[model samples]
Target: MTGKPIDGGAGVVSRVVDVADPADPRLDDFRDLNSVDRRPDLPSGKGLVIAEGVLVVQRMLASRFTPRALLGTDRRLTELGADLDGVDAPFYRVSAEVMAQVVGFHLNRGVLASASRAPELTVSQVLDGAATVVVLEGVNDHENLGSVFRNAAGLGVDAVVFGSGCADPLYRRAVRVSMGHALLVPFARAANWPGDLEVLRDKGFQILAMTPDPQAATLAEALPPRAGQPVAILVGAEGPGLQEHTMRASDQRVRIPMSRGTDSLNVATAAALAFYERDRLRTTVST
Candidate 1:
């Protein structure tokens, strides 16, 4: 049944169902969000894409990921008032206390939306018509992965490619940390690891592997020659950097110049630097 109607002003026609029982089976999708084994976002769990907070939930609504349902307080429902118009899913309106009981935590975000996982995109699909893509290797930290997506969105990256040893970008924490850009950004995992990099090369992309090695050329040196061409910035996990073979697969090794004693940056920070450098060069050349 379509739930009760909420007069979320400004044409919000969301199906607002008031759910008081924290144990209601219909709320299963959002139950025990903190459970490592039960959280809906885990690939091993329900494999659902869960969006937390009003902004992320709003993005989930606007993204390719369709929300099957949303759970939040009445305040959030009103805040999302206009954005909820025309959504087919039900918005389970619950009290803050009940939300805490159901999710196994005091979720201060005050809103959550759940969507079934969308079909995975192909490497070719993400790379299609792309100028600047960020490729990640061994970046297993969800927060760092999320930050990369955030950085990519803010810094003019076109897409993201996941290499071996990366974390699930759709993980709940990743989605939250990315401020929902994870939902908006197009990304795909490599089917052939370093072998698939040949596809980027075939498409005329110059791949620059990011490293901490002082001997490597800086971004300013390596990027200017390729200013008018397509480029792929490759970054790895924090400590080990890119895998040796992955490094060999790249066309150039580049580094961000550092201050007095700094040797390396966080994976996300390093990726941001690379993204910013590429964007700076692109903007400079275009004008």
Candidate 2:
């Protein structure tokens, strides 16, 4: 049931069960993972968060998500090594062919862990003692959302807040693209759009909206004044950018300088720049 077992007078045995039949009832959670109309990851659907690959599966093991089951080949079970130790989940060991038939694909990652979705957190819960946060609007693309989360985790953004028109951060594609950061990073949806933004402001966070307008202040110029205060970086979807009302609600608008002919950067890229700048300023201030 775990990577390794505690010595009960002897070495702990791995709880890997050999499964030959793809249609076994135990494999139900992982069946037809690519189902277009009804995947298990959908909240209204099967309502599970799946972590694919050894690294992501390891992250799931350490995260708020507790895997109820893992499906993978013998090679992956060996590759996972000590990471599975003490894990309570059952590792359903299957051959590549059986895994392929069960999941309806030959996922090269080889290992998949399924865990129940944790209850959603509120904006306030994620912001406890958090100095930097990213607020997203209309960023419905899974890859872009994933990249933003990866950036946030790497660049010191403390949490992610989703405003109206944003995609589900927990989507499988987004989680995979984020390299599992979508599961690791703290995120909450704004029950009310522009209105919930005010909640962040009320928490003493200086909301800086990312915009391409020539009138907006550069990141360097805008971030220092807010150095000691909590900061929220607002980013919109790539093409449409921030909604007008969202922009107006922001305490300040910040932009990255770019070449004249170049298009505005991707939302994730822009947010990364903003997050990096905020991180730098806080570092300088702390030092």
Candidate 3:
């Protein structure tokens, strides 16, 4: 079941097994990955978190979630190179056609890693020492949820808080869209919406709810100095914005300035701007 070394000559430790059969029992974790009713990523199903493509697979290798196994073509294995060093997981090398047969589609990423879901962090745990965090509510779209994670990573947002009615961030589509940042970023779900906001307040966070109200404080004016304090940027779904009750729980309401006739921004875009503004203000005040 073992194949030759993919790269780096003689010292390779990865056990590469060439499996041509799609129905092979060893490949069960990757079979029928696209089946809506039986996808392995479903929390109700096998509950495994999958990282697709070389970049995400590498990110998973670095994250707390350790891969139980990998399925990829020989080309992708060579591309992964020494990143597989000490991975402690078997690499199931297969042909592209075999991979397509197993996954139920042609996955252009050419690589996949399956890992078990790690225990989720608590709200307080993710918030520890966080200078800025994004709180989301009613964002049920998987792609939007993924975009928020990507934005959070790129814009220096410290953590994410899921209020209610949000999509599972670890869903395969969401994880792929986030470029694996969904796995790297710390996040937690609030046990109680709006009420748990009080906990953030008690922790010295200035909660600013992002809304389309032109009358609200501008993003620049909303973010306060964040030296010894923290800020929570709250956003709801795109069209609905923040719920009335959720908005009322915040310390203040904030809006992004827009051109005339434009009153709203996509939820994730708005959150990124808030994160960027907060980081900008923190840098300015610190300097």
Candidate 4:
């Protein structure tokens, strides 16, 4: 027997289009997502950005990335409810089995949103009117990058700048891990590595490079007053701190106080501390 359609509440409209054949061309964009070459989001390929699960899908709806299409079970449609209202994307309703066959994985999350990537933002664009930002280098781990974006969003970071060797924040895994904050968090890639530090410096931002060096100032001592002033927190990948030249370019090197021999915190955690310190100082000054 077929299962009853899922419904969220009264007066909420959710359009459902029945899709049975996995090979239906209408599902092309959602097919073979596991195939290395055919998988979307590859820079050299079709590069469509995908959002999975309910939270990420909702985030995609609120972000600059506009959804082109949505494929999911009626259950998810009901859950989405008013969230999908006025969305231009068509909802391609499919059974759980068919969706698993098409995507090459059972998406327990039940909902997916696909959006064409918008134009890349420039460093100036992301930095403009910002009071706090995070600069990352060699953070190639999608999970870490996603966590950083999540932490940034929760902790009041205004933007994110990728200095070099960072992963694509728009990657499906990153977007999902970030809970879709990667889409909402404005970011830019530096055209020139260390040289770009000069641009931020010229904008009156105090660049604070996070480090484990005992000699560096602690987060409490290093962060400047916010007072509407711009600040950039420079963070490198876990293994390698910021590049030597990049560190030299910054105005100061800052370290999180940790137990002796404990090394350092995760990049995202460290960034959260920096953001917290900045926020704390900003609040203290105002009080």
TM-score, candidate number 1: 0.94
Per-model C-alpha lDDT, please?
0.89, 0.87, 0.88, 0.85
Q: Write the per-residue lDDT of candidate 3 for residues 65-175, one digit (tens) a residue.
A: 999999999888888887888888889999999999999999999999999999999899999988889999999999999999999998888899999899999999999
Would you list the clashing residue pairs of candidate 4? Answer: none
Q: Please tell me which model should have the higher TM-score, number 1 or number 3.
A: 1
Q: After superposition, how far is residue 32 of candidate 1 from its true place, in Å?
A: 0.7
Give the Cα error of residue 253 in candidate 1, in Å: 0.5
- Candidate 1 lDDT over 1-287, as tens digits, reads 12334585334655778999999988999999989788888898799999998889989999999999989898888777767778989989899999999999999989999999899999999999999999999999999999999999988899999999999999999999999999999999999999999999999999999988989999989987887999999998999999999999999999999987877788898889888777784444331
Q: Model 3, residue 276: what's the lDDT?
A: 83
User: Best to worst by lDDT, what's the order?
Assistant: 1, 3, 2, 4
Candidates' TM-scores? 0.94, 0.93, 0.93, 0.92
Point out the higher-scoring one by lDDT: 1 or 2. 1
Quote model 4's TM-score: 0.92
Q: Each candidate's root-mean-square deviation in Å?
A: 3.7, 3.3, 3.5, 4.0
Candidate 3 global lDDT = 0.88
Best TM-score among the predictions, by candidate number: 1
CA deviation > 4 Å runs, candidate 4:
1-15, 224-228, 281-287
**Candidate 2 per-residue C-alpha lDDT over 152-232 given as tens digits, one digit per residue, 9 for 90 to 100:** 988888899999988887778888988889989899999999899888988999999989898999999999887889999
Task: For candidate 1, give the lDDT.
Answer: 0.89
